[model samples]
Target: MTISLHRSATVLFQGDSITDVGRLVEPDSPLGNGYVRMAAERVLTALPDAGITFVNRGVAGDGVSDLRARWREDALDIQPDVVSVLIGVNDTWRRYCSGVVTSVRAYENDYRTMLAQVRDELDAQLILIEPFLVPVQDEQWAWREDLDPRIQVVRRLAEEFDAELLAADGLLNQAARAVGGAELITGDGVHPTPLGHTVLAEAWTELAGL
Candidate 1:
């Protein structure tokens, strides 16, 4: 199964700390330390002639607004053929913990605006990855109320933009149930462990149908 409409397209991953995972600042350093690297490696290995280049522009602790600010430099500049985004958890997380309130309306608006830019300016294929948090602790379980709507918004946007959707939240939830409820994966109920990253890579590969 092919993961892309174009076999040799460039794929770009964007979002917050989860996506960033300390990607090397230098151009020579291609893959990051997290799921991005794992997915890229698998793609390259499986489709050696596909010639897909993976770029991760996820900045640690970034919110949706931060992505908008750097979109030109980090995303559009690369001229990616397929762009995947996994953001919005930080928005809800900050509001839940730090009293840094970003309304759901604002989050949805910002996301739409950014996606519109990608559609009109770059003409790239979009992949909207739902932001997820496994409820390891009681407090974390409540995050779903706020985060779930945002995930729905991503689903809507993907349909509106004719982009592929990777249901990371659903995948993680299933994994948690199977693997002892998030303890086997996420370390802090937010960041994913290496095992969690492997799970994500497999999910992405399956979604891309590669």
Candidate 2:
């Protein structure tokens, strides 16, 4: 699917570590080194006079609840003309690693709450990126049981909101397939490397029609 952008759009990127990529909370290149930065750079570089302002509000290790908590400040307050969300992996990861389970139902509820608020409060177009896994470890494979349901919920939400859906999970899987599941997609099956981020950038820019 093609993503359309307004002439002078204030684009907001929100989510977890994948989007964060060690950005300074202060200023000066807050988009970090992940897909957000890569995509933003490509867009700005391609059209220096597009008047597109990009903001990255992705904090490391954030979940749906975290997003809901900060929605007013990071999202709505930004008055974005377009909002892109790339969250939910942490919610699934914590279940196995930290024993902190966020049931699919709870995950969907929290996600729905945030999206509903954004819809009610802003005229921003929405782009929802799927939370994905690559399974570097055998245990990571099991995460599918929990994560799949959440992915389905996100799909439903995108349909309900008529939002643009960036199918990260499947896209990453397809990439992994070409490389035969090498650590190429994600060094640790979660956080992406620079090369992986490039892969994401290509997908995102194409999604944005940039």
TM-score of each: 0.93, 0.95
- The clash count for each model shown is 0, 0
Q: Once model 1 is optimally superposed onto the true structure by TM-score, how far is the C-alpha of residue 52 displaced, in angstroms? A: 1.7
Highest lDDT, which number? 2
lDDT (10s digit) by residue, model 2, range 12-92: 999998999878564666888789989999998887887889999999989899888998998999899889999899999
Clashing residue pairs in candidate 1, if any? none
Q: On residues 1-210, what C-alpha lDDT tens digit does candidate 1 reach at each position? A: 234636668899999888888675545555668898898888888888877778888998999988988988999889998888999999989988898977788888999998998999999888888888887788987888889888899999988988788888888878878887687778888788898899998878776776
Model 2 bad stretches (over 4 Å): 25-27
Candidate 1, residue 159: CA error in Å? 1.2
Measured on C-alpha atoms, candidate 1 has an lDDT of 0.85
Question: Which runs in model 1 stand beyond 4 Å of their true positions?
Answer: 1-7, 24-29
